[model samples]
Target chain A: MKKLSETKEKRSNLSKRIWADRQLYFMLIPFLLFYVIFVYKPMWGLQVAFKDYNIFKGMSGSPWVGFENFKTIFGNPYFFRILRNTLLISTYSLIFSFPMPIILALLLNEVRIRKFKSLVQTCTYLPYFISTVVVAGMVTSFLAPSTGMVNLILAKLGFEKIYFLSKPEYFRTIFITQGIWQNAGYSSIVYIAALGGIDMELYDAAMVDGCGRWKQTLHVTLPGLLPTIVTLFIISVGNILNVGYEKIILLYQPATYETADVISTYVYRLGVEQANYGVSTAMGLFNSVVGFVFVYAANKISNKINGMGLW
Target chain B: MTMRTRGEKIFGIFNAILLTAIAMVCIYPFIYILAVSLSDAKSVNMGAVWLLPKGINLNSYSQIVHKEGIWTAYLNSFFYMFMGTAVSMALTTLGAYALSKKRLVGHRFLNLFVVFTMWFNAGMIPMYLNFKNMGMLDNRWAIIFGFAINTYNFVILRTYFANVPQALEEAAKIDGASDFKVLLKIYLPLAVPSLATVALFYAVERWNSYFWPMILLKSDSKIPLQVVLKKMVVDMSSRMDSLNYGRDMTGTSEDGFIYSTMVIAMIPMLILYPFIQRYFVKGVMVGSVKG
Candidate 1:
């Protein structure tokens, strides 16, 4: 009886505190309403993925389809192709683009002159600010077969001009290289900050042990950076399926769809252009489910291993 | 400079050369584009312009300035950037201020509610359908309210707000100041640096936004600068008729026109970048560290 009364008193106290801060509650209403309408509402609307949506009938009036949309998407040949392209592109980016920043950071850390170091950092970081549209524009112009600077250089070296953007095989390479060029410097900032936090005494001890510059880097710098590197890597892995389609849409043509088409772009084409809302939503739901699994698994594993997760 | 081994000396020289090369590689494309835009149409067509203009001319810039569509797009982008950033800052500030208070009822739950949106969403198609159903299609509000408050920016500002000295708030409370007044008189003033950083971020994001604007706005006049530039540079053939530059001007070549448009689109960012570059790095670090 005494325990029950104590609990009742605590509940009343909570309500009284809430009443005291009523203005704060008023301040929160707009944000709460925004999330309900914009974020959660669409999440609820995702049920149309399993329905036969009709334009006139609306979301509520759409007929239940019971996995038909998912079945159609799975059976379509384009499904596996785009899926493979997304994975390959993401993997290529992970492999080729991820390490450039660390290497750049290490190299920059080696520089002794402060002014030169800042200059290099600023120059390399500038590209990250350029708009994707402009970047894609520059890429197309530089790789244009007949008049592009790249082709011009190749011709002077006595090689046949290859249409870099048009060729399917070159698509992944171009994307990854551009990804590295655009982000490697900016991404290095985190690693560079990490490098600054390493103990000077550790380097001194390594020097006393007759370690060379490379050895010191290998033993001291790499280990110092390991936690940060692993944390960022796991985060990247969590986003494996979310290779942005904006750059792809800008850079790709119909001829290059074989290699460049990812799930996002495919969904955009179907849902927005072709107006196949049901199938497009189904594919998107599938991508989200897989992405959630990846993120959850990555977070769990990183937490177990390093005590650092994106939580 | 004091007692370095031969290996260290060699490494320094190599590092300097490599960094210089990397810097050049980063800046060369901008130079090339500027050169092409300034060169004569015939020179650009023959690919004679390499790193510098050949027979310098302002014909391409003049042509772009004369185009009605580009100006409309430019005006639309400015409106979106300013209006969107204002709404975003207002919403984010109010939300962050409320959530920053540990004593606020259900603050933990509200924080989690906002943060959860970052991890999962309805994805693209469902969102499109939702917006379409709401009659936001071809509407600027679709772009504006579609991304009113980035959850990451919310978290950054909340973190900053949380760090404001508790004594400051307590003193204001002792003086019988209301929560809104405390926020206005104390917190907002103290958090100007962070607010400016986040505002710049929102501004740049709105300026560069294309995909959402492309999907949301159907009419050519309502499209933002990035989308307009894409139409000109990438889908050149399809949009050429819509451009209506006339057959006479077309004889001079469209390459110069495209390059000039790109340069124009890039000008705002390049101009603002140096002044805000320091804050950009700092803001990104704040997000990364706390994120």
Candidate 2:
């Protein structure tokens, strides 16, 4: 009977030891508080997707509409167009813009002059801090077509001036170019840091083996940068619907809506401009699902290829 | 080390010219706006302003300072930036610290739940409705409350926590230090670089936020600098006939005032930049790879 009592005491002691450290648990309190109060609490309102949500009616009192909102958004012909634009722009951006910073990082890594490299980096990154309002301003000012400097230069070269912003044909070019200009330098910093972490001993061995700069870069630097690149790629894929509607809203006029209108801008209109909460939430949920699938798939592929995943 | 080859030297020269040209193109608009803002209104109207100003004047800046409601806008922005960034940093650090522990039960679930919110969101109307329900509408906390701690920053903060040597936390543990004590006293002090980077990130994001402010803030007085900038750029084109820059009440053309307002909009960012400029790229890099 005494031995059994001792065993029970020992078992409780073992269970207590296995429990999460109290101090660690204490540190997590504020974290849980924040998410619960803000995030998880707000998540309850997500039920509004199934309800006809009116401000005065409130979430609780709002009548359940079932799949009506989703049906409404899905039934609209404009839905496919916005989805197509979102997918197309994100796909192109991933293909073209994703590789640019990698190339820029490679070029920067090869630059022997530290001053020049830093200067180039600073120059490239300058545009990012320029507000979207200002960037759009610059885009219009630079691509004015008639009196603009770009057109003037093009005219000097004996080519017809292109009304880039006003025309649907030139919309993607302007968007992608501005995006590359704004992001390339800022994006390359991660790759540069990754390159920095490459062990010096590895480089020294490659040198002893008589590998030149190009060979060293291919064999040593590129391999080291792979994980960082994969991570960034996964993140970018995660934001598949993040077409950054602010710039598009500021820049796009009715003439270029065919190319310029994305899921976010559409949401802004259906939500803010038109005041359709249910449709907007449904649309937002749709975008979220697509974005989630991409991130999930991207992580899976990355893990398969290189043993690197978001997890 | 071998010297750059003859072809390499030429390539370097070509790269230098290309980069410089791109830099000038990137940088010159702000300079142009600056010169345009400083130039005499007549010079600006005729597009006479060049790389250098025709005249140097603080008329635009002073006029904005003197305007009836402009000070309110400045105050609104300041209140938002100062309180918003501080709260964000604190919440992010504490939350991230807690989540970074592998031993913490439910860590994986917590992570999945948080990261899920990043991609999926309730759209603007739902969010607005959500805010109104919570009594955040027209409140300064509306902006602050909605995004006090970004998940991306939380991830970076968690990564920094993961990086602290386990043995160090254990030693502190052996000394009978509580979790909060070790986090506040030991971990935070050691993680200055990450903390600074995250703080800068939040500060910049909060400062640059326009859409939320435009949505949640109904009063013009509550609008931030970006909102004002948007008005000057977009609404100004439509409302150009309403403004006159000088005493004649017709003294300056709409173009002159528009350019002046554009330049005025840039001043805050420029002023606030030097303080956090060094950390800007480093912050992005950390948030990108590790986040």
Candidate 3:
């Protein structure tokens, strides 16, 4: 009876606190309402992955198919191909595109000319703002057989013109190179800012120790950037399976699908193009689960190693 | 200041030269595109237009202005950018402000809820289905309200709001100012630069976004500039494809037309590049520090 009264008193205290904060709660109403509709509602709709979702039948009216959709996806041979493609593209991107910004930042940081530095930054950063459509279009035009700049250069060099876009072997290189071109400068902003935060005294001390500029960079600047690099790296690891399909969809053609067809693009083709909602949702759910696992593992490893976590 | 060694001087010169080459490479594609677009069709076809225009003409540009649905697509894009940014800023500000307060009810859970959406989402199929179910397919409101707040921007704004001097809030409370009034009169005024950063982020996203609009909006009348540009530049044949574009500019060539369209689409962004360049570094810094 005494314990029950103590619990009652705590409940009343919480109620009083909530009443005092009613105004703050009122301010959050619209945000919460929209959040539920836009975010949580879709999360709720994940149930369709289990159901044999028919567009006309609606989500609720659709018949439940248990794990049949999941079975179908696993049973299909194409799923494995897409999975392999997804992993390869993301791994290639991680290997090739990840270090570009850091390299650019380090290169830019070594320059003492303010005007030259800003001009380079401005030129490089311009591509990040260009739409994916435009970028993909530019890629196509630049790789065109006869009139394209690349082919023209090849001809001038006395080499036979190659249709770079149609070749499966060339797809990953083109995609990775385009990713670097579009993003390297903009991604360097974080590193540039981090570079700015390093103390002048460290460089001075390094200089006093007879360290040259390169040595000072290797010792002082690199160590200073370690935390930022680690954090960004962990984030990228979590996103290893989440290759964006927008650019891939824009760039890929039938001839190049052998190398270019990732899981997200396959899901896109199934759901939007074919109207196969049930199987597509199951694949999507699978992707999300894998993505969540990657994030959880990355966070766990990060916490164990450095006492830092995404949470 | 100590005098630089010869080695240091040489290294500096090499660095400058390398960086200049990189910058030139970065900007050269756009220059080439512009050159190709302005040159006559024969020169472009013969690969004669390399770094500069030959037989330069404004025919493609003038032709694009008269193209059907181009003006409508531009108007649609502008509308989306303005309305979408406004809604996003409002929602993000309110949500971030309330969540910023440690004393607020369910504060921890609310913050987690916002950030969790970043790590794991329902993916594309469910999202598209949800919009379709809500009769939002082909609707303009779908474009605006569908993606109201980006969580990264929310976190950045919330961090800025949380760092606002609590002493100012205490002073405002003593004046008997309500939470909403205090937010508008105090927090909003103090958070202009941060707000601009987030707003610009939303504006650029809204402008450049084509995926959802391509999927959700079916009607030609409602599609954005990027979609229209994609149709002409990427999918269509670009040789003698100018017959349907305009009558007087019949021989202007579709190759030239595609380049012109790309240039036109890029003009707005290039104009706003300076403004965007100013705030993104600060914005990125805040997020990185908090992380």
Candidate 4:
């Protein structure tokens, strides 16, 4: 009887607390409903990837054909090409674009002139705010054969004006260069902040030890930046497959598709443009699973190396 | 300051020169586009318009102002930016405020519920189908309500809210203020800078949005400025000879029209960039510290 009374009292207390926070709970309803409908509902809709979806019969009435779409995608040679393109572009980004911001930050940090540093930062960061469409558009125009500035410069230098966009060989270079130009400065903000946080005492200690600027950077500054770099590198590894398909879709042509097309763009072409729903969803599911595994594995490795992995 | 060594002086001069060169390279594209847009068709075709306008003309600008779809798309973009940001702010603010309170029921679970969406999502087709199922296809609500809350922005706001003093809330509560009243009377005022940062993030996102609007909206009339600009600037790039615009107009050219449209599309962002710049460092710093 005493235990039952204690349980009832606890239950009443919970109810009373809930009642007191009713308005707060009410405030969360719209956001929760949004998540339920838009976010969680899509997870449920991943079932269509497994099922042979019939548009007329809707998502529920679709027949299950476990892994058929996956098998079909794997059987195609084009799928392998897409996968290669995705990996190549991602790896190129990692190798080239990843180190840019760090280099930029280090370079900028060594500048004693505040005005020059700020001006450089402001100019470099401006491109990041420009729409992807505009950037791709500018890229297209700048590489145009006849009237393009690049071609004009080449002609002035006595080299033949080449159509850069149509050449598959030039696509990856253009893409990677454009990525660096657009993002490097904006991305340097984090590293700049990290640089600011390095202890001044340590720098003074290094100075007393007869260190030059370059030696101080090598010993003290680099060590201070190591944690931030490791964390960012891990995050970049996790995002290896997500190569901004929006820009690719904007920039790439049919001629350059061999080198430029990535998995997401292919999924878009199949699912939205052609209305091949089931196969496309399966492809998308594959992409998501691979991305998730990469993130999970990277997180696990980071945790093993240092106890600072994202939980 | 210590006396500078000769090597240090040389390095500083070289660094200054290199940084100046980089800044010039960065700004050159915008200048080229602007110059090309303003130059005469004849000069542009002659490839003489480099770095500066030759035979300057405002015909392209005039044509854009008078164009049928351009103004409509511009208005549509502004509408989306304002309306989308408003809805997003409401959802994010309410959600952040609720979750920031440690005493809230299911606090840990609710926080997890939101943050989990950040790490994983069902990808494009599933999301597209969900929109199709919800009757959001070709709808403005697909653009607005479809992406009402970004997890990063939500996390930023929540972190800001979590750092607010508990004593202020208690004091408000003692004065018989309700939860909503306390939030409005106390928290909202203090969180303006953070709120502005998130709002600008959403607004700029809505403004620059191309992919979803291109995919979701089927009708030409419903498309945003970015889509319209894409059709003009990018689509026309491959088929330059097929461009039929400005043939009758004296000073206008195919590239000029395209470049002008890009400039107009870029104008709003360039105007708002200073304000956006101020908040970016602060917002990113705060977000990195807690989120």
Candidate 5:
């Protein structure tokens, strides 16, 4: 009875303290309200994924049909194709585009002239800030079969013009290449900052041990950058399925859907364009669940391996 | 600097050449687009304009400027960018300031609540439906509020605010200043650099937003520049051959007109880029290191 009275006293003291800081709580109300209305409320709307939703019946009135939408999604023939395309594009990006920034950072580090290095960095980073709509426009104009610069060059060399954007086989290559072009320099900023953090004493020690420039880079520099590389790799793996669909939607046509259509775009088409809310939300929810699992697994693995992971 | 060996000298020279070539590859496409936009209709149609404009003309730019709906799109884009950034910065600053207080009740829970939104969201369709239900569809507020506060930017700003010395706030309090006064007089000035960085990020994001705006705003007059640019490019590319037959082939080809629209769309970013380049790099570094 005495312990219970002491606990009640502690609770009153805590409430008093909170009351004293009511101004701070007042300041936080708008932010909390924004999140509650904008972020959390929609999460409640995600329940439509499991329901047989009707436009007239609304969210609460819809009848629950558990797993039917998921079944239909799995049973559909286009599901695997889009799933394959999404994974293939993301994996290709991981394989091809991930290393380009590191390589560019390394190359930029080797530059002796400061002005030249900054110029190259600035020029390369410019494309990253350009709108995706403009980039898509440029891509189409540059690869246009009849009047594009690439086609013009090919004709000059006596080669037949290839319609690059329309061909399904070329979509992945174009997408990955554009990804590299747009992001390599911007992404390299992290590695460059990491490179600056490396101690100069290590380089001096390597030089004392008769290590050449290349040898010093190989032995000391790479080791110093290993942690950063590993951390970024884990994060990228977590986001492997969450590629931005805006650029793909802008660049793709009906002819290129065989390779270009990913889960996000497919969901957009079905849910928004066709008004098939239940199935699209089901697909979106599935994608998010898998993404959550991937992130969880990646974080756990990274923590176990290196004591570092995004929390 | 250490004395360079012969091999190091050779490597430096080779590196310079390679870096210059890479820079050219990065920049040449924009130059080509500019050239096509400025070239005569005949040269552009014949694909003769490569590295430079053969015949300079301003017809494409003039035509695009005089085009209906294009000006409204530009105006909408500017309004969205400025208004969205202002609201986002205010909300982010207030939230970060309040959450930065360690003694604030439920700070941890609030911070975690904000962070959770970063990893998980309601996805696109549900978000659209929610907005539709709120009567936000076909409204400019939909675009503005759709991306009101980027959780990543919020976290970074919160981290920045937390690092401000407690002595400053304590001094203000001892001087009979309230919490609001302390935030305005003490924290705001100290946090200017970080605030600028976050604002620049918000501005760029709002400027580049396409997906959310495309879904939310239905009216052509209210649509931003990107959606219109997309429609124009798609239409022009698909009907390229038809343009050569009977269209008034004057100073600019149909392709040149499309290129001009793209250039106009890109010019704002290109102009502001150099000014923001330093801050952008600093912002990214701060976010990555401390995030």
Candidate 6:
């Protein structure tokens, strides 16, 4: 008799639990509607890469092109050049820009005074908030190779003024170093947060072992922030193909296109400026695929090594 | 006891100097621009105004304010940011809540679907053409809907919701509260900081956005501030013919006002960032810890 009563009561409770969450479920409806309409439905249009699309005829009426656009992109004379520039610039940025934030965070962590630390942080992040156009414009004006401040200083110091923007050799260096200056401080915030969250007990233990500040930072702080570092690294890999069209467009001209013109800027020129939709779409699709692959590979490796990744 | 010897002392000072120098390198150039913008045109052109304004003035700022499309661009950017943030926040919160529930129907499938898009996009041209077909191309709504649910933000939000103590919901249930009531009464209040952070994240992303806006916002009338900023950077007189964009007081080219326009584009975010800074890092990146 007791068992029977308990079973009946449990069943009633289960039903109540299931039915009680209706409004919560109701709130989720619009988001589901949004994804279905925008993301999912549009995924069907990926077929356009294979089709000879016409603005007037539209997707349904367009003739099947079947790898023609892809073929043309591959056959294009400048495909290799653009691809190389994209890879080189991304690689340069990755090498220089990736590690500066971690190091900045470490340096910031050592400062005992709160006000000074914050001032350092504030000063660093200010550059990031400045518009990319202005950053590029500043870069242009500063690197004018003669009258610009850099050259002015160079001339004072008895060095020849190197034309930073117009020279292909100097373009990647200027882009990467300036990229570091603009973003390293802002990016350090993530690592700083991670560092801040590390258990104080770990540092205490390290100190008990006679570990120096450098040793504690190397052993404790670095490892504690490892997960954040890994995740950000993977996300950045996914973004490698996104070579910031606005700044690049502003910085590049016919003279520097040899090294500076990347896939994003190239697509903007051909697609938006020239209005050739098909080839630019092919180029964009190409960028997405490569980015997707890099992200996937990085995540997989990170998962294998640390059991932490974007996946 | 002597571990912190003379070498250690030197290292510490060296580290401090390097970092402080780096900090100045990051900051001083922009300050130079600010100085130049406020300086008299003669001093600015001659590079005398690198650190300080030659003649203190507010003319440059007023000149940009008086530009034709500048105000419209500001309004357009706000419309996209405000409306876009509202829709994005609503969807992300609800989607997160739904998925956070362990007993919810089809939760696994939904999670998988969201994550799949993160790894593989449907590519840009398709996204653009799709927006075109849905009568949304060239629409701010198109921009709004294009990035409605970022998987990263979705996961962060879910982490926040999932961390909400289950007992709170259970007690609310015992009180005859619906799931909606529990979410509203309990979760929303607790999740305010996270919501503010993520909302700021969405706002920043929407504000800083340019590429898709470049594709979708074909209409000149609907251009966002970032797009206009881009045009100005590319060409000084992109929106203004050089004739029309001249300085108000001195009657020279609007070089004085260029920095002013860029500054105007930046002000809204700057004003909004500090208020949310307290919660920004923790609230948003808490989702990152789920990895």
Which candidate leads the pack in lDDT? 4
* Full ranking by DockQ: 5, 4, 1, 3, 6, 2
lDDT per residue for candidate 3 within B3-113, as digits (tens), equals 688998998999899888888888898999999889989888777998999999988888888987888898999999999999999999998999999987689998887
lDDT tens digits, residues B1-291, model 5?
A: 567789988988988888888888888889999998898888887878888997899888888888888889989999999999998998888898899899987988988899888788989999999998898999998787767889878877888888888888888788899888888888889888888889888888888878888888899989998888888778755665344422333334677888888888888788879867878888887777534
Best by DockQ: 5
Q: Which sections of candidate 3 miss by over 4 Å?
A: A1-9, A307-310, B237-252
What TM-score, to 2 decimals, does candidate 1 have?
0.96
Query: Which residue pairs clash within candidate 1?
Result: none
Cα lDDT tens digits, model 4, B1-291, are 556688888988888888888888888999999999999798887779888999999988898899989988989899999999999999999999999999987989999999889878989999999999888899988999998999889999999999999999999999999999999989999999999999888888889989989888887678999999888766666674343322322333868988998999999999989998989878877776645
Given candidate 1, what's the lDDT at residue B112? Answer: 88
Q: Would candidate 5 be rated incorrect, acceptable, medium or high by CAPRI criteria?
A: medium
**lDDT per model vs. reference:** 0.87, 0.74, 0.87, 0.88, 0.86, 0.76
Model 6 lDDT tens row, B85-196: 9989988998898889888756688788777877777665566667777788678777877788777888888888898889998998899987777778999999888888
For residue A72, give model 2's deviation from the true position in Å: 2.1
Could you tally the backbone clashes for each prediction?
0, 0, 0, 0, 0, 0
> In model 2, what are the clashing residue pairs, if there are any?
none
TM-score of chain A by itself in each prediction:
0.97, 0.85, 0.94, 0.96, 0.98, 0.85
Stretches of candidate 4 exceeding 4 Å from the true structure: A303-311, B240-252
Docking category of candidate 4: medium
lDDT, candidate 5, A74-178, per-residue tens: 999999989999999999999999998898889899987799899999988988988888888888888877777787788789997777887899999999998
The TM-score measured for candidate 4 stands at 0.97
- Candidate achieving higher TM-score, 1 or 2: 1
Worst 10 residues of 3 chain B by lDDT: B240-249
Check candidate 6 and list the clashing pairs: none
Candidate 6, DockQ score (0 to 1): 0.40
